[model samples]
Target: MNARHDHSHQREFNLEDREFRFLVSFLSRETGIVLSEHKRQMVCGRLVKRLRSLGMRDFAAYCALLDSPAAGAEVEHLVNAITTNITNFFREPHHFDHLRHQVLEPRLSQSPKKPRIRIWSAGCSSGQEPYSIAMVMAEVLKPSEAWDALILATDIDTNMLKRGADGIYSAEDAAHIPENYRKRFVRRLHNDSDHVQMADELRRLIRFKRLNLHEKWPMKGKFDAIFCRNVAIYFDKPTQRALFNRYADMLHVGGMLYLGHAESLIGMNDRFEASDKTVYRRIR
Candidate 1:
């Protein structure tokens, strides 16, 4: 009886081809994320909980809700469900190392004016990437008051943005942080040893906001570096080309752009010249 009930529930939630295609089209148009035929299962799996939460029995009903005028609010929820957020403190350590040595350190030693450093973590999942960047910035910019340094952490996921602004994480996740940074920038909770929070100092160095890359960006000033890692992979070739061109415009000449290990600008855009592994310097 239990097995039969579970099977029935599963059958009720099956996504039909029409509904899957609608989802693929809606997602691409709304968020610039392309969902191909192979991603159908992944889409279904990820959105099941959203369906269940809305008391939906099938994908057809969910699709109808998305198409209706009432979808304005639900749209946010749908995009959040479809988007993936996976990151860690110093997930790609090499990028951080490059940021320190090639970007920050040289500016500190050679630049005559008060150093002004700006970095954007374009798809910063939660808060880890920017926080890792903040740690390095704070370390290099001695007597922090002397330098104007800031990290802008942006994501389309409001939930992720909130989590990043809160700056709290599981204690075990702290293991990923370098020992020196851990000691200096991580704070133990008053009574909860199971969790930790980013130090106020590091938190002060960052600004978190919800931004869809497909939309117009609000920032006016150019950045010294942009870490858009792992994000362009979700976009199609045309979208990736446009986005890279936009990044080039947002960066200063000789500023750096960091891509995910799987992402490259080889033939995508020539505005940037390769600087290091998965790192490119804006030349024009």
Candidate 2:
């Protein structure tokens, strides 16, 4: 092990105003993440671990290192440290409810033989969101071989993408998945039943990739539905507006767009119409 591991975790640094402003600007410009004055302590708390890991004693030293040419490669690590990864199976259950009843069911029954079903989980932190979509689809698209159901799970954090690809979760998380679906889509770990793996069928349905929503997206086709829930909450209004417009462009006309309960498209864009609480349908 490293000698740094022996150091006490109580190290503290008084972050300076100039450093904070530079950090805020840098993060916003590079990642489109708006860091406000109120988030100073939160930013400090998150980056403190990074500084300690790199043997940085003060925020000024950290800032100097970050501004240096050698720091070009560290931004992803910085983002991994700062990006929030809180997610779970079937989070915001109503979204799943809407997805099942309003989205998938109707598609399954479409008369002209709809063989393709595409869903995008825009901020699929740790895989749960996309897995949830897969679980629902697995049940709805009976004899799953009949449909080309695919889920694109994307996040800016590479670490989160790895975890999502691994498809492991604390066993406690199983409770959030509906009982009927859980048995088919979840498997207890061999040595530890207290943890679980998403079943192969579920994993097979999702394609996890790293995507920074603010940057140019390389995806080609329009999706039938896009679940960007809770992701826009951190972006400024203009960013949110631009993102939603881009989502609008990427979604099929009449496709569904699900937002976090705390987020809304009100006064932001006109391409979508409210179809359900906190849900919008692409209309234009």
Candidate 3:
């Protein structure tokens, strides 16, 4: 259960129609995260803590704060509160399998000109996906010194980016990662066995930054692969289409794009052909 989890049990607040509409419009305009009428309860539930934290009594006061002169600093917290960061290490294993067997392995046979490898973890939450990817990269390209490899991990939530950069995770989080990668990329804390840290070698391969997908990306060169899984499911079809096209533009001609199991590019974008279930390869 993702954002749909019932939150009606929380202390209820009077969320007026005007405030809700303003919220929906503001979120959609600023971050491309659409909040439908049906999601009002979920939105309220997610943001109730913010209201409490700001010492506001109700949604009206919260909405007022968003429109006030002090709104500049709160916008970051607003996005952090509203967005759902549902992710796990190797949440979708098949994609990484493909990245290993199909993507990285092929490059191993390339000409002596040491190939450059770039992978993007769009909406990477708390760093697991990119770190998992880093493990795969370093494994496939060990003596990785020969090749230039980098993983750019970006998310709209600055908090998530900071956590990802920190590379610390609950011990339970390490359970989801496959054994081979687990041993190689992560190590348990000597003092606190409850947490694990991504190894320095793997950490060096990633760069985490706060980014709004709706805004123009600052990256110059194309990536060899992009993992935007489960990100666009919250966006409207038109937004998803536009985002996918932008991803296509940012990828080399034959670069791979991995989506969530529930997401696909069918009827949305034509520049890609399905190379595998929930995976697309740029063709045009």
lDDT per model vs. reference = 0.93, 0.89, 0.89
Model 1 scores worst on lDDT over the 10 consecutive residues at 108-117
Question: Which residue runs does candidate 1 get wrong by more than 4 Å?
Answer: 1-3
Top model number, TM-score? 1
Q: Give the Cα error of residue 137 in candidate 3, in Å.
A: 0.4
Model 3, 63-94: lDDT tens digits are: 88888888997889989988889888888888
| Model 1 C-alpha lDDT per residue in residues 121-156, reported as the tens digit of each score | 999989899999999999888778888889999999
Runs in model 2 deviating more than 4 A are 1-12, 111-114
Give the alpha carbon lDDT tens digit for every residue of 1-284 in model 2: 35565443344466779989989988888889998899998899899888889998888888888898989768888889888998888888888888889888888778336489899999888988999999989998877888888999999899999989999988888789888998888888898978899999988899999888989999999999999988998899889989999999999999999999899998999999999999999999
Give me the overall lDDT of model 3. Answer: 0.89
The top-ranked prediction according to lDDT is 1
Give me the displacement of residue 266 in model 2, in angstroms.
Answer: 1.3
